[model samples]
Target: MIQKYPVGIQDFEKLRSENFLYVDKTEFIYKMADIGGYYFLSRPRRFGKSLFISTLECLFLAKKELFKGLYIEDKWNWEQSNPIIRMSFSNIGHKYLGLKDAIDKRLDEIAEEYNLSLVAPSIDQKFKELIQKLSAKRGKVVVLIDEYDKPIIDYLGENPDKAIENRDIMKVFYSILKDADPHLKLVFITGVSKFSRVSIFSDLNNLDDITIDSRFAGCCGITEEELADNFVEELKTLDKQEIKRWYNGYTWDSSTSVYNPFSLLNFFRKKTFQNYWFETGTPTFLIKLAEKTQLYDFSEVEIGANALAAYDIQKLELIPLMFQTGYLTIKSYSPMSDVYILGYPNNEVKKSYIEVLMAAYSQSDLGYGVVYVDKIRQLLEKGEIERLEGILNTIFKSLPYELWQKENEHFYHAIIHLTFSLLGVYIQSEVQTSDGRMDALIRLKDFVYCIEFKLDESAEKAIQQIKDKGYLVPFSAENKKLVAIGINFSREKKKVEEVKWEVIKA
Candidate 1:
């Protein structure tokens, strides 16, 4: 039978029954058996973390029928099936009049599943009792908690101290698992972001974070190999150019590139590609993240080397934000460093972020997303550079500099690059080439534009710098015209002061 894409469908049983196209990561089940007993994996929202955990639940419950034709069918022993207990906290309350009491209510539901009650006063006691009772009832309990950090993540900055208290409560409850291990077959947990070090997940000391474990990296999301092999028919019906520009690019591992399961499946299902992930609603926490912590330099800010496993999520670090929101992905692994080089995950996540950044920079004028790209493309193909400059000027004029003032000179330039870069436009900040380095490189179709920006410096000086550096030498062999532009910024108005342009014929 033919398979269709499983766009938003994550329920394992539901997908199997409905015949939603399923990529068999079931091989991972056997792969994981050899790894640690307790594991934690963090991925962006809608990246299929829930589905992975659901598959795990099925495996432990010894659902042999489900694995009959999958990758793990021949690899597993179908003789033993353990008792399964699954809990998802993605729907936890974001706003609570009482906070602590709201957490109690949420945990209470998990308690009911085991017919366990907390005769003890605190929520932690309720959680501990629930786990202990479940462990006793079955020969071995397989506990799968999806979005384990959701309780506190929902209240992160709203009432930070309250968030801390909720974390403390979870830490206490999870700590019980160490003793419950005697009766626990396996335990798995997942979330959008990891806990902010200390006092969180304090109980699960044996928790093995496989977020960067190279062996299972392809478990949650779909790799490009899987896409090309599985979705060849679907691609034949779509606009190939539009599809690549929107859904391609997340370089997870150099050897295995991945398409966002969320966006890829949706694009085929609807025969369209819009902001499928954002449709769930922007994580307001992202806005609060920048505002609470003065992280004004996300764009052009370089993180030289880092490990996804060791990256700190505490008190707002760039790596976590980039990872949590789906900007940076695991690119390469170094067993010695135990680290991963994180970079843009896919075209959709990167492109959609401009909409978020615009709102952060200027709450007022972010209304005009540079998405008017096709319109820009239309004009460019029609040779409307003069009109293009006018429109560019108008867009800059509308920018609220005051909104980005905190970022200083760096913000000014980063925002400029970010603005154009977000529109699927190719922008290079401080690029280096054989003909000497350029402050910026803007590519539109076959044409290449070299640009230099100056503040309190003459536009002529900036223009001369471009010429002196021989920035135009490299474009000599191109079929399209090359343009060199010098931009002057006003220390006075704090916006694009003036632009000097020199267009060269091919």
Candidate 2:
């Protein structure tokens, strides 16, 4: 019998009581309880953080019946029950409503739940009193905060000043955890981004950030083994490799690769390959930041793991925003240099980001971009170089004037990169060759396109550079037709000016 897929079900008791399919992560949850007093985990939104927090609430409440046959049933102590002080910032409306007001209302509800008298007027003071009162009356308090950064991240784009103010308020609110350590049993915080030490967690200095810790890397996401073991019936009819290609590349460390839990569950239920998670929350602020900066290449972004965690209201680096928010993930890591190479986590993110970027930068609808990408693929497969040139020209000319007002090769490279990648074809940009680097290389089953792009120069010069630099030499071993194309973008005209090509049998 196939179990019901728990899509959008954040309540642990409800999920288990309804006989929903659950990938067993209780082993890691048990381990976390044993190891740390205060913990923080940074995962993309809807990656099972809420459900995990709910599960923690049940465990602390000693709801042992819920964990009947799970991994932690025998390992956990069922006699000990703590008063859980659950504070969720997940569904707060802080855009129009005041954030402080929201916190006060939630605190009021919590105080009433525990039947405690609140003397403090401020939100932080109320939180402190709740912990102290709960510890004195029942037992030590277990605090689980879900989406702790939502108040700040929600207003980051619309009102940055509001976001910063929220950040300061949040800092004071969380600082109580340190002072109330004597009354706290365990504290777990989950959010989308990990703000730096000096920013959000400055006062709460004892937070064990298990974001990149290998031991708990598989805590939040469904692993390959978990998927295969739990969904045996689903695998009989599905293409496993295709599923992996679409949703299984999010990694916090080099060792473990996890499937996006939200997308994977939806894929099984819908029986379709779609950008489920990306569509749910695309982060428009991030796409706009990518375009405005034009300062760096999104296709070629590399930063150390430490750099990826340094995000705050004031410092909005595109790399950290993308990396932490699930657009980009760890492609590889160099222990020697202590740097991590970040790229699109899976095909879903790659295609969705291109669609979003195209719409935002080119002022075209997503459907238009998809149709044009299909046209580009057809032209490339049939070796229709001139028609491909016309499509490129049309695409560039259609872009908004504000987009191309500044002349930056990185901007052009990013646009072209998105265009080809959206075609759902194999592509590599700025590929290194022995002599020099190739601007773009596209691969088809029967043909390969060695593309050289130049700005404010003749197409002939671009073609000469491809040959002079021996960019096509790497493809000599493949027994397919090699097509060399040189394209020039006129900075003055803000459009493609020339295209030259030659197809040679390999």
Candidate 3:
């Protein structure tokens, strides 16, 4: 069978008609019909959210012809289709700072089709006028707004006052949702960030957020089952190891152990599994947020609800922003402490994020392609602690002063192992041992080295954790010497505070 790849394309009908690769998420359609009147999904860009929204649009518009051979092809009742009002805010703020002018232009593109002349000066007025007319004419309206937070997010940092201005304007306009609830059948909205509930849904009391709801987990990204089942043919054309390493770590509620929709398609189309999503755009907002917070070593820190909840994020909501914006995701949720473990969604995100972080700090992207094995070989063969420490120190110094937790302490200690592996160093993070997690394990050229890093803790503690936990117990008889290192970091100092190395040199 010929393989199909949908790359940089979000339109549902087009993809369906063109016979592009499609992972059937038609189940979400009926689920949507059961959920609350309005829906909100927050995921990182290029996660197939736009396409999902488009699918919703097709369903609402009763375009059943496009869903043939899909899960929901025969499940939906086409007779109940409603008129969908779709709007995208990609180029929203070019002419309007207030909702009035910005929305006016958008209304002119969509609301004009209703044969209604919207001359309202404010967004609230224009929205009210359009909804009233559209509802009165069609009897029901299905509102699907894509990238609903784009205007606010794009305006931010570039111009905060304007974002604030647009926020208030959106408040008034969207408030009509409550006022026009009876006339609206289905409302689906998507955005990059989950802003204050007070910001967008002032009156959207029925807004249902299925973002983390385990039921609708597979609504956006491709699932592992879906990828394996559907894209197995495509997989045959790519390097299996590289593909998995780059795109396959995300496990959303079990079913979503999958590839990045964007990167997956791009890989098939371009015949390479490069950093497609990361190269698509630089998350300047996230970089700025990190710098502004001086949050050194983001990877090393264990974050919680206060970190993920959009409701309490103060002054840009960096952690919460990271979760919603796609840099991190809930890996594990502990009920006892109500703690959630967040990390890169997949190998693709991990590699891309590291590249971006490296570039931000060092003004150069770490060529994380394959040299990692070589680095691991060298680091372990000669027990080159200085070489590894020196590379990290130089990169850590490249970090802007604002993001410096401590000038001498490198914030990247969290991923020193991941970094080396990313560089093809063949290292592992949090490797298991009878003593404890070896923290890191580097293997290359038949040689293995166990490594550990600690900050605000003694080298003895770092090494002892390995000893107490028996972290190095796994490689005792692997035909090679086992190396262990406990490195301490000083936040105020920003570099390696001390390095204590011990090797079971053969």
Candidate 4:
């Protein structure tokens, strides 16, 4: 019998009771509970953070029957149950009611559930009162707050003032966790973004942020080992490597990578490779920010450990935002300098993200962008350089006239970069050689194209630059056919004015 995959089911009791197949993550829960403390984990949305929090709630509530054959079954002391104040900011009706009022109402519900009354008026005071009363009545209370940043993240881009207001309210609301530590057994908070400690978590100094901790990297998502172990029958019909290529590259510590559970499960259900997770929500703000910063290429983005540590709303850095929100992930790390190399996690993210960026930059619909990208891919595969150039010119021609500026050179390069990047082809932009830097290099199965882009300059000059810089030197001895192409965008025409290419011979 095939096991039922728990897709979109966040409730642990419902999942287990309904006989849903669970990738056992109880060992991580045991590790955390055995060393009980206030912990905060930041993972991308739809990566099973909510389900993990629900499992934690069940574990703390001493639901031993739910863990009959799981890892934590015999490990946990099921008799020592604690009052669980489980709150998910995503479902708290914060959009209709204000953040503070929504939280206040949730606190009231929790108090009522425990058969306790709270005279505290403020949100923080009410939180503290609930914890103290719960600890006094039952044992110590366990607090599980899921999507803790939703109240703020939802308002971001749409309303900065409201986002800031919600952040401040959360600052005061979460401040109680620190003071009420005596009454709390465990406080586990999960969110998509990690606001700087100076912002939302200023008062909660003791909270251990294990967002990038290697030990718990596999706590939330489905790891390679876990995927193999759980999806035995499911793997029989699936292309394992293709699946990995599409979904399995997200890493926190650059040591243990995991598949985006939302996408992975959806893939099994649909039996097709699609952007299941990315389609759930578009990163409109991120795309706009990338365009503002001209950050189309993410192949070799490097940042210090401090950069990924935290970022406040006032100083919204693009790289950190992309990293935290699941667009970019740690590809490599250098301990000597404590620096991280970030890139797109997988084909799903790279293709989907670039498609969105292409649509936004080109001022066209996503379908048009995708069709152009597909055409470009086909041309490259067939070595149809002339047709490829025509498509490139057409892409630029479609751009709105009003959006062009004198310094719109980067805009042209960005569109081209996003176009090639979307093809899931091996590509490098701004490639540095011994002599000079080359604008772009695309490596296909049968052809290696040395490409350079010039603005208000002759295509011959761009081609000569590639030759002078010895850009093709690296691929000189490769088995594939080599070709050099130069493209020039005219400032007056605001489109590709010249396209030149040469078939390199050894």
- Residue by residue across 288-332, what tens digits does model 1's lDDT show? 565455453343333334423333334656566666557666556
- Give lDDT per model, in order: 0.66, 0.82, 0.68, 0.85
Identify the runs in model 1 with alpha carbons over 4 angstroms from their true place: 1-3, 34-36, 92-136, 239-245, 251-255, 291-301, 304-314, 330-341, 371-389, 400-411, 426-439, 493-495, 503-506
CA RMSD of all predictions: 3.8, 2.4, 4.2, 2.4
TM match of model 2 to true structure: 0.93
lDDT of 2 by residue, 464-506 (tens): 8877777776787888787789888877777788999976544
Clashing pairs in 1: 175-203, 250-345, 250-346
- The digit string of per-residue lDDT tens for model 3 on 1-506 reads 77667787788988988888788888887787645388887777888888888888888778878987788877777887666678777655634445566677777777767777877777677777777778888878888888877767766677778777767767776887777887788888888778765566868877887777788777777766777788677666667777766776554453345567788777777776567877778668787676567553444346665556554223677777777777776667776786777667666676666656545554445553234435545665676766766655654565566655343334455345435545431334445444444556666455565666777777777776666666666667787766667777766677766777676543
Clashing pairs in 2: none
**Roughly what TM-score does model 4 have, to 2 decimal places?**
0.93
lDDT of 3 at 452: 66
Off by over 4 Å in 3: 34-36, 92-99, 119-121, 237-242, 251-255, 311-314, 362-377, 381-406, 410-426, 431-439, 452-469, 486-502
